[model samples]
Target: MILSLIVAHTRNFTIGRDGGMPWHLPADLAHFKKTTMGSPVLMGRKTYESIGRPLPGRLNIVITGSPKPSDNATLRYVKTAEEAVKAAEEAGAKELFVIGGGSIYRQFIDRADRLYITLIDADIEGDTTFPEYDVRDYGIIASEHFSANEKNAYDMDFITYEKIKK
Candidate 1:
């Protein structure tokens, strides 16, 4: 199956501050929803805990070393990122969304074929950061620039990068 990493980060690659996103961009969120709507989204335990519940409209696969979820049918648990991806593939998924925290991103960075990155122009204090990317290794397939209002503050660019042949 084809794998992709989808995340919105600041220009400096900041993703989260205190277990949640530092900035809010409605357009970016809408773009995320549209892109991963019917697909299987794979995430680490920390990422899953940060959200508190499974996001609707997509199959949520959480990678954890834990036992099992308590009757939460929406949440599927796996041991590792590869296993999580395998689970998605077994379900006939063509693309797997690697929505993540730092560790998971690091784990799957080299494995993903594409990255759907929303580059936020503003920066805030953050703890979690995006994985390091080499521009020469990937080609920007698409992009959309937008700015949020006072309620959701941030100017962002939704950019898609596909890995270029080495």
Candidate 2:
């Protein structure tokens, strides 16, 4: 299975606060949609609860210890991260997008082959964060920087990193 992290991180790698994302960047949202559309997205129970619903246009695989989904909206549920990855692969998914909170991100980071990161240029006071990874282990394959105007008031960069062979 090829796991990949899809996240928007702040300057300090902050991901969220109070369950919702700390910032809103249309460009980043668009980038996320473009990349993860039609693929299987695996997330933890807490991450699913945060979103309150499965995202459209993708196979939503929610991982929880209970092994069942609270609602019928989720595409599938798995007890372990390995099962989640397998389910997606069995469903003919070419890429597994790990959309996450801290725990899920950490659980799958080592399994990830690529990283799609949206770097937010701001000092955010957030409680959740993306997992730390060594930049030297991955090469920045692509990057697109954007500056938000008065309506948005923040600058961000859409970056994609591919793991380098050691």
Which pairs of residues collide in candidate 2? none
Candidate 1 lDDT score at position 5: 96
TM-score of 2: 0.93
Candidate 2 local lDDT, residue 63: 85
lDDT of 2 by residue, 1-166 (tens): 6679999988888999998897777788888999999899999889998888889989899889887654654478899987988889888988899999788999988878999998888889889988888988999999998989865668888889999877
Candidate 2 lDDT: 0.87
Task: Put down candidate 1 lDDT per residue, 1-166, tens digits, no spaces.
Answer: 7789999888788999888987767788789999999899988888888888999978899988884855766568988776787789888899999999888989999978999998888867799999889978999999887867775687778889999867
List residue ranges in candidate 2 displaced over 4 A.
69-74
lDDT (CA) per prediction = 0.86, 0.87
What is the Å distance of residue 114 in model 2 from its true position? 0.3
| Candidate 2 weakest lDDT stretch, 10 residues | 66-75
- Give model 2's clash tally: 0
Residue 56's lDDT within candidate 2 is 92
For this target, which candidate reaches the highest lDDT against the unseen true structure?
A: 2
Question: In model 2, what lDDT does residue 50 have?
Answer: 84
